[model samples]
Target: MNNAETLDRRALRKAAPVVGITEPGYADHSVEAGILKSIGAEVRLLRWEGKRDKLLDMLPELDVIMIRDLPLLDREAIAALPAGAGIVRYGVGVDNIDLDAARQRGIPVANVPDYGADVEVADHAAALTLALVRRVVSRARQVDNLKWNIAQQEPIYRIAGSTLGLVGFGKIARAYLARMRAFGVDDVLVYDPYVSDDYLAQYHARPASFAEICGKAQIISLHAPATAETRHLVNADTLALMNKRTCLINTSRGGLVDTDALAAALKDDKIFGAALDVLEQEPIGENCPLRGLPNVILTDHTGWYSEASVRSIQEKAALAACEILTTGVPTHWVNRW
Candidate 1:
């Protein structure tokens, strides 16, 4: 075995296990630190600060690595990890990680899929849908600028008796459906080929094609994953099927929608409005066409954030690390080879 692998095994046996975190936005790692400390592990925050080489250099020393969304752990980084070392994602979405490389290296990768953010994301989607349908943000802006009773300038639609469409009927989508149902949304249409018809019937939602949902539903919310089949599911052709009264809300993967098509639709008033918690490119590029659209509402992809959810994800990720260190397996293990 290499010196790094030898050192790691020795550290695991004699010294405290080393767990490193990369590019965390949290104020402190106290929660994760406490969890790892309880298992006799040392927590190190490798805030490489956009320095990829530095992070690569530190990977060899860690028995486990916990990461969020930033500073992607690509193949090179994964290959740098010593044998027996494992990686744990802070939350769902392992697209940023090079899973194939980790699997090839026999380095187990795990993620905390259920960190209790379903409610938060669903609430955010509902909020965005309401804001778009009611012209809430525009009205507030006009009211702040000394405009009175300007609601008539832009038509507002009542939430009751409207059709709700969901791109994916996962946990977040189900939670969003419940919230919309409370708002008097009776006719629900869902387009998820993976789910069975019985599953849709259980929730009182009708299974429909993507075109049908776009053409029929007044409010469409996206809760799909980012995959090759799902990318750009909302493209020009689909946007053409939407009516002027439609409102699109995406709290899921940004790649699910075609930004250019949506922007063009908004520019032409082809749809009512759109609210998004995610974008095709994060920190949204300056050249992005979606910016400066009055009818469009954008958030910093924070739909999965809440104090409780943050704490939950942190604790769960740390526990996964602990499991890797102690049992050589994680609760939500992914990339199994």
Candidate 2:
């Protein structure tokens, strides 16, 4: 063989599989690099600038992709994926990914569902709930502005005898209930249709309709996924059903609540207050009405975040990528062809 042809063959034989990250957010890629190296794969940051061109440019070289918050992987993007490539979402929610498209293309898609973020999210939900009920955030702002003795100005109800409501009975919801129960939340009305009555009874919670939860519970927390059915689950009708003194807490998907409806409710004092760790539009749009609302507290979707949680998710996601690259099978496969 010619010298050039021999060198080309040698290079092809030594090529390593590349695992690209849609957008690199972590301090370093050491964890992903270490895990995927065992399977002869290297990690590459796509550095996707929220543009389709950036994704298309990187798709050809990637054998697997690990995604976090941005860059929605739609059908077009799925079509551009390398043959036999796989996708692994960094966290639980795969709403940003096109699972059906990946399935049709015979590309396996997986998510790290049990990376120990349940505790962090549940704790964050409880913290938001407390801040909402006790007027902690608002009161702190008031105190910062030199306003004191405002207890009666903004009524702070006792949580000891109030009822708690959970929109979903998942691991995070159950953990949140455990925390609220300590604060004397004896009555818990759950609105998850998927959970059985016996299952809820084990947690001393009773199943209730959505309207009943809004009408009866003094504090309602949402923990549902963002599917078509669950999108805007908290809208005008549901918000209208809520007692005026009720507080809403959402640490789950932002799409679960209608931002406009929620803004109107808070403006009219339809509900007592709301503390949100997630928003319909992240980084919050400039025109968002909830921006300066005293009755609303907004956070930048940090409920599922912690130093430990970040590391755990990174490790789990890398392991999933390694598994898929080595065996063509992911641990928590979402798209099973």
Candidate 3:
């Protein structure tokens, strides 16, 4: 090739914008690549294995980053990112990303908050609640072990006359309430300072404090975010307020519940049972206390997963990255400068 041709190719390569996927969990990057290609952007997979040094090394030269729950973009990581590089979280939570740090650095951060996961998340929460209340997992195991017709071994409760308590009144929480309402759970107490009592009344729900919800409801479900104030919202003190017939369900952030405190409560039969989708720690640690508890049902933080939801989040995240590259702004910008 001629020298001029080689120079022109090099210039074109440098001119093309680069978008990095911080953690590659999706099956393929076609959705991102296809969207980014219109703006001459190249999709680069970082495959960050939760390593600080490696992430720092690869931070330079990227115009945008798309991340999903790995190698937390904390203060240091946020500072390491190239100046003005936009960060897009694939899901609703930004707890892994330091929004304040990004704002300080003049880096805009966005999240795929409306990725259509409300239906899936609400459905999962209800399924877990039903499983826990009816001892579905335990009874299935009993039958598997050749112990049939053991209905008297475990007591079951009816959902027809139960009071439902919700920690947050977000989209997912409201969706869950609708499902529970169909099952005759009309009496509801919601604990969201952001939501007004009149608004709660529209849904036939009364606004209550966290303590009131914990103490009064027969079934308490956590739908709040994981923040400084909400961390360990379900601790020993809150669990103590729950009666023996109370059942707990958490499909939101795992950090909302204290793992050790919950295990201790279950061991002591403080509550009837509990079901969890997300945990404070991902891929649950080997020594995690909630591992072998039969009363507790656990899922691999997949409450927001479905083929359609996955596609929706991927498309939305890609569009966010595309906007940041082409327009220097995202539609759902959270941490704005």
For model 2, residues 1-337, the per-residue Cα lDDT tens digits are: 2323322332443358889987647888889889888878878888877778978878977778889877788988888986567899999999988988887766788899999878999899989988888888888998999999997878999999898989999899998888898998999999998999999989988999989999999999999999999899999999999877999999999999999999999999999999999998887899998999999989999999899998999999999988777666787998776
Query: What lDDT score goes with residue 21 in model 3?
Result: 89
TM-score of each model, in listed order = 0.94, 0.94, 0.94
What local distance difference test score does each model get? Answer: 0.88, 0.86, 0.87
- Model 3, stretches more than 4 Å misplaced? 1-14
Give the candidates in order of lDDT, highest first: 1, 3, 2
Question: Cα miss at 72, model 3 (Å)?
Answer: 0.3
lDDT for residue 238 in candidate 1, whole number 0-100: 98
lDDT preference between candidates 1 and 3, better one = 1
Which tens-of-lDDT digit does each residue in 307-331 have in candidate 3? 9999999999999987766666689
lDDT of 1 by residue, 1-337 (tens): 3334533554556468789988755877899999999888999989787888888899998888988877688999988897668899887888788888887676888999899979899899988888888888888988999998875677888899999999999999999899998999999999999999998999999999999999999999999888999999999999999999999999988999999999999999999989999988987899999989998999999999999999999889999998888777688989875
Name the top lDDT candidate: 1
Candidate 1, which segments miss by more than 4 Å at Cα? 1-14
